[model samples]
Target: MKNDTVGRLKMGYLPLAFVFLFFATELSSQVNIADPFVLRVDGKFYLYGTDDKKPNDGIPVLVSDDMVNWSGPAGNAAGKLALAKGSSYGTRGFWAPFVVQNNHMFYMYYTANEKIAVATSDSPLGPFMQQEFRPLNDSLKEIDPHVFIDDDGRKYIYFVRLINGNRTFAAELADDMRSLKPGTVVECINQSQPWEIISGNKWPVTEAPAILKHQGKYYLFYTANDFRSPAYNVGYAVSASPLGPFVKYKENPLIRQTDKIKGTGGCEFVTGPGEKLYMFYHAHADEQSPTPRRTLFSNAIFVPGKAAGESIFQVSENKVFLKSSAR
Candidate 1:
């Protein structure tokens, strides 16, 4: 695969390891959450994602009064939410469900069998009901749906779609959040950058896009490279507007595996009760294992100086420490 394409494919799950490693502990008895999508509601923390064990079973949920201590069996503690009736398109199990609260409704955006769908519920922990069949774009292979609601009460859904044969496209959703608006699907990045193109074979890449708007500028963090390869890493792009004209970070691969955390990528950010930003992700427990199991991790995001335009941020190794005791 081409190097640029490799980077884009690896983006799906690499930065997540940085988050999991940040909260690493000596206690071996604690439960680990992988592909975690965190939310703070009613003064409590709720995490929803798939358990790493099966990767193709039902989606898992974990509850914590505090972010530090997460407790649950891999598949037992919480209820499993499956595809709604008439939506049996998923041959494989459900994977990567991201939830957002809009107008007193909890909307879950998820991927199953490489197609994206939406489910709705009243509570964060939901017996969610699927409401859509086809993806926003009928022609594209859709996966990794991340819903972003801007400050103006306008809703936008960002996700990875296959365009051409060897590249991924980032597109915006309609206000209904079910279909892509005309002229909204924009080609954000291609798998042809100098670092991504490799060995004369360009890998169609790009997945797991997480966006954060801070101080009037939009920052898009994504994973790249082959998910099954050791070279998988995370990269970033910046845009003046959410719709893009995104400029790639000069020092791409913002977060990657070093000697400490082996497998990386799949990252999402959450703000706690006190307005603290925390990045959550997953990584492999043992880099050398042929079939390495992934563990969830967390880290902090910081901006050194306030500037316009675009600047780069780096993901570094953080000492694992208890941030809060279970309430």
Candidate 2:
């Protein structure tokens, strides 16, 4: 009788131990992607970012149903890629992917081999590839391509040009969506503010440009400082037009590092349940050592200036931590 009781006790404990181990793995597993951008289509969210673990895979994508629990692409346990390497223009260095839908096709604007390029796919979970394997323009080395289409249907591409230490620039994209329009290139924002300077030096580094149009004004959201710096943060500039004579907000560094997290930047906005705005970004995995392999984070944005008829965006210090468990 005592042996029977012991066997039953051991079986009950086995299930309990398995449950605990599963949740612990879920809570501790990091996404391991940098420069995350979330795109919501038909109530399902697809995440694309710089693939730190498999750079040769081109762009890696993760999927989520409720924005809290994320899984590998296509319900796979692991190893799924949206843009495969050698299938596109870039041989390596694919970073900062931004996607947009036009005419029933999805276009992915991203950095490859330190140059801005665009690839297209029928679906957002894309094997996005280029018609001809080439960078957008070969005149200069650029990264971080953000394509914005205005209300009147004019398209503009905002990117980081390596002219004077990673300065941000904007130009009209040609109708083909593969090249820039002639004579439309304009410098959007330069790193002149003190917070934008890196390591007490006047190093101009403003990249990861995201444009949000609200109340008929263009708000350009960008990251400042070297991305590896603990001081790397997010700020915004307001302009009347897409190609902007943009004015930096008086209160800059909108999304900054906290006591626990460092290298907090790479801001991308998306609307969640009931139209609540959320900003997705990444931070250094280790506080002491900043590297390319960062962890993803998101937070709710409170925009009081929008109620006042202005272009202002604010993210709370409290973040929404995403788990890598079953959705």
For every candidate in turn, the CA RMSD to the true structure comes to 7.4, 12.0
> Which RMSD does model 2 reach against the true structure?
12.0
Q: Cα lDDT for residue 89, model 1? A: 36
- Deviation of model 1 at 221, angstroms: 0.7
**lDDT for each residue of candidate 2 in 1-327, tens digit (9 for 90 to 100):** 010111111111112332344355564556767888888889998888887766656887778876656787542212457888877788888899988888888888888889888889888888788778888887789998887777777888889999768889999988887888999999988888888887655557998988777656787889989987888888889888889899999889887567768888777766655445567888887867766555554444434464465635566555554556434
Question: For residues 1-327, could you state the per-residue lDDT of candidate 1 as single tens digits?
Answer: 010111111112224443474446445344444456776778876677655565565565656665665654322213444333333234464666788776687777777666777776777766566543554445557777787776665556667775543233556667676666777667665564554443544555656777777556677877766555555566778787777888887667766466756546667777653454566665655566513335444444534445554334545455232232232
Task: Give the number of the best model, judged by TM-score.
Answer: 2
Over 4 Å off in model 1, which ranges?
1-25, 28-34, 73-89, 131-134, 164-168, 192-202, 290-293, 304-311, 319-327
TM-score of 2: 0.86
Shift of residue 53 alpha carbon in model 1, Å:
3.0
TM-score of 1: 0.78
Q: All candidates' lDDT scores?
A: 0.58, 0.74
Clashes of each: 34, 0
Reference-based TM-score of each model: 0.78, 0.86
Best by lDDT: 2
